[model samples]
Target: MKRITTDELRAMAGREGLIIQGCGGDLTELVNGINDMLTQEGILQNGDAFKDVSVFEYDGCTNLLFSMENVDLNIGKLAMWRLQSHETFGGTWLSDYLPNRLGVDMDQPPAQKEKPDCALIGQDGNIFNLIGIASRTLKENGLGEQAKEMRERIIASGSYDKALCIIGEYVNITSAEDAQEQDCGFEMGQSY
Candidate 1:
């Protein structure tokens, strides 16, 4: 999770916040190597480069904290990109950040499906019971996968309103009276 991001650099906005970690070795050697790298990259030369950057032992590891005021952020980014590849440089588990961990293609739109009816009003308001009704409705409509997804999201939703909303996402919520009305087309109040 250790990555020097472009946005982070901007947020710092020319302040003191860059740090480079050293793998177990001579701390002095690690510091010298970094200077050599910056010089090789044509970013900065040795001697004066380490003036603002401090090397010290921290939590059983040597860390180089760079005071960002003296260092150009763009040049620092270039240096960081190069440093990330070093076997004994940066910190543990450094890699590019990804927003969606589910591997789902966020670009594609969800398929349009006609939501089936589920009677929730005046029915058992218990969350589990409501979930059962919603799941059954979806399954009856031949949407077994959506039913499963709804179950997972509803249970982990962490609140009643959230769970109800999840059920509503997959099915049409109806009152008990409306369900009965849909079952029969005759007018309930009629005089002949």
Candidate 2:
């Protein structure tokens, strides 16, 4: 799959387009999820608004994006949704084409830039299985396509360490010992 370069993403900022976060699953399912999310939030009343949105891979993140060339959408509502939900499933828009109706800057990054953490220790020692686990985690969190790309990149990685490095780019790795400690506590606390 072709990767969207950061430069290309920067160029997109001027267009009246959007890059929504927290979208995952199969392409079709993700699109549905996007529509559901928007509809639940009362951003839109219909599901067809996101039919043209596609999975856009940028900066190791899988985002649902509406590029300039994409079918026209209610970008005004989407921009407001991004601002209103700044604390949840946060997203940003390409500001160059933005109408500035919200009075907030779209080019600025959020308060936090932390990547989500994925437990790595105590996982299957095999690289492929590790990739599967990481991919599943990502998918559950709305990064389905990023997970696919991570899997492919890890497979092509020359060594296990290199694969781990690639994985780290997408998520923070929790140590095995820490996982074991937590699991031990959970087991001890179990009533059964």
Best by lDDT: 2
| Candidate 2 residue-wise lDDT at 120 | 81
The digit string of per-residue lDDT tens for model 2 on 84-123 reads: 8766655666563232422334565423324556788777
Cα-based lDDT for every prediction: 0.59, 0.61
lDDT of 1 at 137: 81
**Which lDDT tens digits does candidate 1 get at residues 1-192?**
122333332222223334566555665676577667665666663434544444445446555555533444355555565556645555321121111212333344434567888889898899999989888887555465688899998878899999988888899898888888778865567435
Identify the leading candidate in terms of TM-score. Answer: 1
Please report the TM-score between candidate 1 and the true structure: 0.40
- How many clashes in each structure? 0, 2
